[model samples]
Target: MSQSATTTQNPRNPDRHQGLANGGTTFAGVLLAVTGLLSIFRGIMGIAKNDVFVATKDYVFRWDLTGWGWMHLILGLLVFLVGLALLKAAPAWARTAGVVLASLALIVNFLSLPWHPLWSLILVALYAFIIWALCTVKRGHT
Candidate 1:
């Protein structure tokens, strides 16, 4: 029966209920989480099965598949955690980090294209969208 009783406002940042309230941030977060999980799975595959990816010839970005796996694993975890943060009443830092992480994701996915063309491209697209969403959020609003 009291206003404070049912309010979902976070005690730390009471200006808004959540950054996700605007929808874009929430959507971005969801996308980030999905992409992160996908990357994680791909990383596991790469690390567990070195033969999973075809070795390329004359590729400028050639490298060990296992190495790529480790990169994906670490980056994916960071992206996923940041995305989760955005979904809540996250601070401004999360948005900034999301942009950074998504940019890095774009680079990683792009570089790994030789190994998994389709998935890498798909991830690249997803990361692009995530960047847009995170960037579009209004300043001082979330």
Candidate 2:
């Protein structure tokens, strides 16, 4: 039988807290928190008229940067809260919420790609990883 069907353990690493034994949820939680914080900072910068973000002029989805900032701020706040909730890995609902929030993050990052290409793409990748991490874990495994 394959490994996943039988067990969630790494044969090479007996350290339960490190590998799939822990489902990488702990790492996901921490990364999500950091990503949220970064987004929050980016939001503040956009709201403050800081020229830190380079927005495209002739983009298809052009809008007031302030509005985008607000979206980022709200999304980041929710993501941060969900990340914190995932820390305990107690309530199953937290995982569900995390997955949902990660999906939203992906969309937000994709939409903001014209504003900041590299960072937005990076965040998209992070959100994808978060979604993968959240989805891979079996209930009660984390």
Candidate 3:
């Protein structure tokens, strides 16, 4: 009988830390922090001049630009905090929170698209990066 080779599993699986090991976490953290700063800037701009973000269509949902400013400001602050925590290797919860907040920011940006299409697109891309960074790591495996 021919013997089959047996593959041994890594008792101490380090793949979970691959993100951190390969500087993935650092890049993600820096990107997240930058995203937060950009959001804050956009929020301030929106607050300063509500009309700057003009509606593309009459039927589209329109919200008080000031209201969006507050929302973005709050979320930006939270995202910034989480980004800092990630840099410090705080915990998984921080990353998870970042993902959730990024997702929300994406939705908010989408609704606010009529205001500035370019910026909205940028936010969408950042949202995708945040989601990918957070979701790529296997929970328990990491």
Off by over 4 Å in 1: 1-21
Across residues 14-114, which tens digit of lDDT does each residue of candidate 1 receive? 43534544576788889888888887887898899999889789789878899998899889999999989988869989989999999999999899878
Candidate 1: worst-modelled 10 consecutive residues by lDDT: 13-22
Error of 2 at 100 (Å): 0.6
Pull out the clashing pairs in model 2.
none
lDDT of 2 at 133: 81
| Model 2, residue 36: C-alpha shift (Å) | 0.7
Instruction: Sort every candidate by lDDT, greatest first.
Output: 1, 2, 3
The collision pairs in model 3 are none
lDDT of 3 by residue, 1-142 (tens): 2222221234345553554543665667787788888878877877888776675667377678888888788878777888888788767887788788878888988887777788889889878877777766654633
Over 15-101, each residue of candidate 2 has an lDDT whose tens digit, in order, gives 443455255787778877888888788788888884767868888998789888888888898888888888867576887888898
Clashing residue pairs in candidate 1 are none
What 10-residue stretch in candidate 3 is worst by lDDT? 1-10
Query: Candidate 3 — what's its lDDT?
Result: 0.75
